[model samples]
Each structure stands twice: as structure tokens, then as C-alpha cells.
Target: MRRPLRILQATALALCLLTTAAPASASAASSPAPSPPSAAEAGPVLAVPADLAAEEVSFRGGGGLAMRGTVLSPAKAPVEGGPGRPGIVLVHGSGAGVSRTKLREEAVAFARQGLSVLIYDKRSEGYSLFRRSYPQLADDALGAVAALRSRPGVDPAGVGIWGFSEGGWVAPIAASRSADIAFVVLVGANGMPPLRQQTWAVAAGLRKAGVSGSLVERAEPAMYRLIADGGLFPEPYHDPGPTLAAVRQPVLGVWGVHDLLTPPAENPPLVARALEKGGNRRYTFHFFPGADHAAHLSPDGGVTRLPELAPGYADLVGSWVRDVTAGRTPVAGTSGPAPVQDSATVPMGPAARWESAPVQLAALVLFAVAFAAYPLVALVRRLRGRSRRPVTRAARLLAATGAAAVLGLFCYLFYVLTTGAKLAAPGPVAAGRPLIWLALQVLAVTCVAATVLTASAWYRSRGSADPARPGERGERVRLGLLLAGGAVFVPWALYWGLLLP
Candidate 1:
């Protein structure tokens, strides 16, 4: 009688806890493009002169939102009715607080070359960490273009757009949609999808910080894909291929030879190919040595940033824009030294439907419940004074280690990614693996071994079990859960690089 009753109570307790556990899971703006000369032959850094006139202005941007900005032009205003100067509207990179001020130095540099420059506050309405509309950003750029073109001192027909970093994606889209934009200037632009670029960037940062092993080779990219599949990453799969193909205007794409964010060696050829595919050949590519992603000075291969723009960067843009806007567009050419890439980009595709967010959440809940049931069932029997078969030491080790390994991997990965890979401080590393990661791998192995020993113990005890004993069935059920958790742990560990070499 007590045997059946104990079975019923344990089953009911498992159901209640299972039900409860299931629901528990929840860019720099500015200096971009072109060089006065090859990096080795580069001349003195051109000083940004302050002899520019900046006027406060406002314009209507995308989504009918009012945007405010400043127009930096020659200190000596153009004579009334005189031929207007060429114009360039600066589109900001991705971020909420990026304002006109952020690009003021670049604008001042452009204005000093006798061009009209418009730098505006990026729209906050339809932009954020998890949300953004590139088309909408392009519209806002067109708005700035219109505002700058309307000024009496600017040449409406000569107006073009300059985009850096995130703006690289937005600028081409704007140029593709608007015939009014005369030429396009991109700095530190990415030709791949946002997800791939991000994954590469994080991995590069990790490597730069002295991290190696599977962290860079495998887990880093895999985690990014998983995050993207869960919809937490904004525009993770946004492809620049079609947008670049649609651009009809002349393009000047530039990158720092030391750029860490975008793959300099890889992007230029891709951008050039895309432009040529669309029957447009007025493109020029340049690389700047000792420059970071933003074309800013970075002496240490893009690991650190300096306030000054790379030598000759602004002068190159000023000259290139003037030439292209004046119908002197280059047929097609690449200049400067070759870029250095420490590693090849990892291929990333969309996660399968079976591996999507909801399914992942369900898996987590199942693993948690199954492993937890062992110790929990033991505690319940002890409190209720219910006699139960003794849980072998192997089964106890399996339950504790399996649960710890899964939870540790999840938490550690989250910490590494959220804090920008190695930037947020990924403890100490030994033999290229973080200390915490090494510990988790050990736990994963322990789980596997414990699973085997626990199974052996269970087999030996099954022969000794009395079906008629009150607590016999309940003890077997608990052991079964621990074994089930171990079964799932092996594949989970392998998937996340735990069991990988």
C-alpha cells in the first residue's frame, strides 16, 4: 500500500516542480576614407583649422521627426549669388547619444577645405540597442542632405554623404534610394552581415586581449548566432550586398590597416565587386596605417584610440569629394598598403527552427528540473520521514556536477559576451582557456564519468531492490532523473564546445 502511495507522492511532487521550473527562463562618427598618399609615403598630419563658421540649424528627419544640427562652412561666407561650394552631409554611426558635436572635428576639417558640412543629432525615435531601421536612418540622412543643399552657399548638385562605421551601412542605402546624393564616402565599412561583423569583431578583440583556444575558434561565434536567433541582437542578419549593388553614385571606401571592427583586407574587394556588379566603376579604396576603425590614430594595431585623425585622412576626403563632385570620379582603383587580418571570419547562418529561442528555453527548463529532482526528492523524503533507498555517492556527484556545469557555462558565456568578450575581464587564462572555462570543462567531464558510475551503481542496486518495499520505486525514479540529466549534458557540452578539442 505504502509503495504505491509513495510512488504517487513522488510523481505528484515531480509534476509540481516540473510545472514551475518550465516557465523560468527569460561606432565612432567621423573621419572616413581615402589617403593623400600610401601610408608609408604619408606626409605630416594636417591640422584641423578652427577658421570655420558653424550655424545652428534644424530640419525634418525620418518619421516626421524634427532633427537639429549645425552647418560648418568657410568662416568667410560665400558672396551672395556667387557659385556655391560643394556640400557633404555627415551621417552618424549607430548609437543614441551621437550628436553633431561628436563629428564637429571632422566637419571642421571638411569645412576648412571650402566645403559645406552638415552634422546632426542622430534620431532617437526609431533607434536603440535592440531596434533600428536603416532605411529610416537613410531618410534622416536625406533630410540633412536637403537642409545642406538648400543653403545659398552650397551646391545642391554637388551634395554627397559621408558615413563612418555604422553609418557605412546607412549611407549606401541612402545613396541607392536618392538620386540627389552625388557621391558616397564610407570609412571602416563592413561588407558582411551585421552578425558576422560583430562576431568577428568580438573575436578579434578577444585575440587582441591575449585570449585564444576554442573561445575564439568556436564558442564565441556559436554564442552570437544563438543570441541572434533569440532576437536579442538588432539587425543581426542585415546583408549589405543588395544595398551596395543598388548604389549608383561614386564611392570612396576607406579603412585603417589596423582596423579591428571591420575586416579591412576582406571588405574593400567585396565593396568594389558589388559596385562593379551594378555597372558602376567610379570607386576608389584606400588604407591608412596606424589608424583604428574610425580612421583615428591607433599606434598599436587598433587596440587604442587617439583623439587625432590618422595622418592625411581628412585631406584625402576633402580632395576626393571635390574631385568626384566635379565629375573627376576615378574609374576604379585601390591604394595604400595591404590590410592585416589575424584570422578568417567564421561562417554564420541562421539557427535552425528546432534550435530557436522557445526550443532552447524548453531544453534549459528540462535539464534544470531533471537534475534538481534528485537532491530535491531526497530532501522531501527526509523531511516527511519516508523511508527510501539510499542514494549512491555516484548518483549524488552526477546530479550536483551536471547542474553546476550547465549553469556555469550559461552564466560565463553571458558575462563574456555582454561585457564585450575580453573587454569586460574574462578572469585568468591558462593554455589559452579562461580559468572559469577550464573549470567548467572539468565539471563536464566529471558529469560524464559520474553518469557512467551512477548507472553502474543503479544496475547493481536494481537486483537488490524489493518492489514491495515502500520507498524502492521512488528512489529508482530519482536516480532515473539524474541519469536522464547526464544523457542530455553530453550533447549540450559538445554543442557549446565543452567536450571539443
Candidate 2:
């Protein structure tokens, strides 16, 4: 429930942001007439170095979208009859939608390590949102693959992809689609099914914000369903297992032991199991002790300055490319201990993508209709000049209490979805917390009171039933409203873990 609500609120936020950003985006695209990049214009490392060559390049994606990036290759020409210089295309992470320049650090570092690397702008940056489907993203990646393989010194047989975060999911599927891909490097990848991974991510986030573990567990499924309907990323039905198994190439998995962004702790083992089960013999997994998502960290995790790209992170990946392409067997790490978990069997099952979207949408519809009924009825009565109902005081209180309770729960949901993630970062829930934890604390109390009050009214009204009642229609409507609102509010309250300690 929390995750889905977060996504919904976030989508609304993105649309709002896009409206403001549209003009800037248009201006940038239309006004762009910069000269082609020269050696000096390229950054320090990317400049024409003695050992490296950088080229401004572009490739046609699905529907001929011109995705652009820089391809960096070793200046040393490939030796004839020797293994072609190994190469890799950089697959974008979730935020890869930012811009091509966002990947400069990774590209330059890999280029320095002596591998041909392609870092391209993600299609999502300029393409229509609806057109950026899984296959289309994969197609864009494959386009880069083709471009990289065609590079002057790149070995067509040794070129593959290095994917981070969501790219992890996209890269494997792209690789399995063709034998052209030689190997895969998955960094900060989640081995969990997409939906499960997202749900777990939301749950962990809540826990970090001081949400209790038990409540997080309770709220996870409802949140999963919410995500199914309208989450940011269209949940793909990609089961990474079969695809991971299908890859005949040696694979390397990198993770940070303390990573919460993608929860690397769980996924590395999952990746290994599936690969081994699928008959993939050469697999290497490495864990870093003190890194977060994006593989960046500080000595004590305080906020750091720009270019916090993890030390030696890119080098590890670059080294893997060096070893695999040099005809040496894949090593566990560039210089770390062997993989903690050896190969094992991973249970294969259907992905949780959209499994609960329909039912969750049904619940939202029910709540919406029920929430609107009373106000619409009151407006009609006012316009028609109907007299006020002579309902008993108890029934009126029930209606009031129920409405208040529903209002509280709805507000809390809105608050969490809007501000929880940002506010959760520094530490414990603070006084200036956006959710107004006190309001939620008050909401929890009022909801309990409403539940008790409504139940009491319901029981007492039955005993006082009068078939000849004058305000029978209005009274019945109000009673139904109270019951309906309570029905919606109670479960929502419970699902959000609002009633928990």
C-alpha cells in the first residue's frame, strides 16, 4: 500500500515537474548546435589520451530514435590473430534517464582500464513515455552493442554489457535475445522478481524511516498490489532466472553488503543459483563492505561532495572485462576474497508483476465511490429543499466519527507517499517531519474511537428499529454511509500499519 501510493504520488509529482521542465527540454533540444566534440572539449580522461580514443557517436533505436553517447576505446590497436580488445556497453540504471553526461565517470573509468565502453543517453530522456517499453529499451541497448562491436579496436566476440540497478533487469533479457552478447556484469542488481523487489524496497524504506518491521511485513502485500496498478516503472514480467540461465557466457555479480537501495544482500545469491542451475559454469560474485546504492559511500556515511563514484568500483568491472577477454577464466573479484556463497539451486516461479493490480484497483474504486456518496446525497437534499433527517443522536455520532476516521487515514496515506522517502534519510523521525507524525498519531487514536463508536451505534440502532420512521430513507442512507465508510477505513488503517505500535 505504501509503495503503490508512493508511486502514484510520485507520478503526479513527475507530471507536475514535466510541465515546468517542458520548455527547458524543448529549448535545449531545438537550440543545440554545438560543434562536434574535439579532443580538448572532451573531459580530461576522455581527451585524446596516449592509451585511449574517444568518439562522439549515435545509433538508431526502435523507430529510429537517435540515441547518442561517446564510445571510448584503447588507443592500442587490436593485435591480428589475438583476441579482439574486449568491449562493453553501459546500460542505464533507473536514473539513467537523466542524460548521457551522467555516465561520463563510468565510461571514462572503463576506458582507462583498457576496455571499449559505450555510454549512451537513455531513450526515456527524449522519447515518448509510452514508447519506452522493455523491448524498446533492450533494442536501444542492442543498438549500442552493435555500435561498440563495430568500433575500431573492439573485439566483436568479447563485447557485452555492464548494467546497474534497473539496467540489471534490462541487460540480461537483451543478452538472452541474441548470442552476440559475450558476458554480463550486473552491479547493484536485484535478483528478486521485479514486483517483489520493488515491494521489498518500499518496505525497507519504511523501516528505515522508523516504521516497525512487523508493520512493514503486514503492509507489503497491499503495497505490492498498489504498485501493480500504477507504479513508475511498468513492472515487466521478466523472470531473470531463465534468462540468467540461458546466458552461456561467464557472469560477474557485484554487490555492496550494506546496500539498501537495491538490497544487494539477497540478490547476489539468487543470481548465482539461477545461473548455475541453467548450466552456466563460470560465475563470480563480489561483495563490498561499506557502500550504498551507486556504490558510493563516506567514512561515516555523512553527505559527500560531487563525483562520489565508488573508489575501485569501476576498476573491478574493468578488470573483469580484461580477464575474460584475455582468455583467462573469470576470477571471483579484482582483489577480494572468493564469493561467500558457492552455487546452489534457485526455485523458479512466475514473476509478481501486476498480479494484484486489478484487485487493488477494485478496492480503490470502492473507496472512491463510498467516499463520494454522502456529499452527493447531501447536495441533492439541499437543492431539493428536503427537510433534515430526524436520526437518533447515536447514528449521527457514528456518521461523524466514521467520516473523521476515513479522513485521517486518507491524509496519512497522502502524507507518507509524498514526503516519507526524502524525510527518512538523515535519521529518526524528527519534529519537522513532513508527515506530521503527530497527526498520524492522532489519526490512529481517532480511528480506533470511530471503530468502537460505529460498532456500538450499529448494535444499538438494531434494537431501536422503527419501521414507521419518518426519516427512514435519509436515516438508512446515513447509516449505510457510516457502515460503508467504516468498511473502507478500517482495512486501510490496518493495511497501512497505522494501528500498530
Best by lDDT: 1
For model 2, the stretches where C-alpha displacement exceeds 4 angstroms are 1-51, 75-84, 125-132, 213-215, 230-233, 300-308, 331-411, 414-471
Q: In model 1, where do residues sit more than 4 Å from their true spots?
A: 1-50, 387-389, 421-424
TM accuracy, model 2 = 0.75
lDDT per residue (tens digit) for residues 286-394 in model 2: 7665555556654433123136556777778888777877778873333343222211222223324433544444455554455456556656878989756433444
Task: Candidate 1: give the clashing pairs.
Answer: none
Give the range where candidate 1 is weakest over 10 consecutive residues by summed lDDT: 18-27
Cα misplacement distance, residue 427 of candidate 2 (Å): 10
Quote the lDDT for 401 in model 2: 45
Instruction: Evaluate residue 499 in candidate 2 and report its C-alpha lDDT on the 0 to 100 scale.
Output: 60
- TM-scores across all candidates? 0.87, 0.75
TM-score of 1: 0.87
Backbone clashes in each candidate structure, one number apiece?
A: 0, 2
**Local lDDT at 483 for model 1:** 87
Give the per-residue lDDT of model 1 (tens digit) for 194-220.
888888888877776677877777777
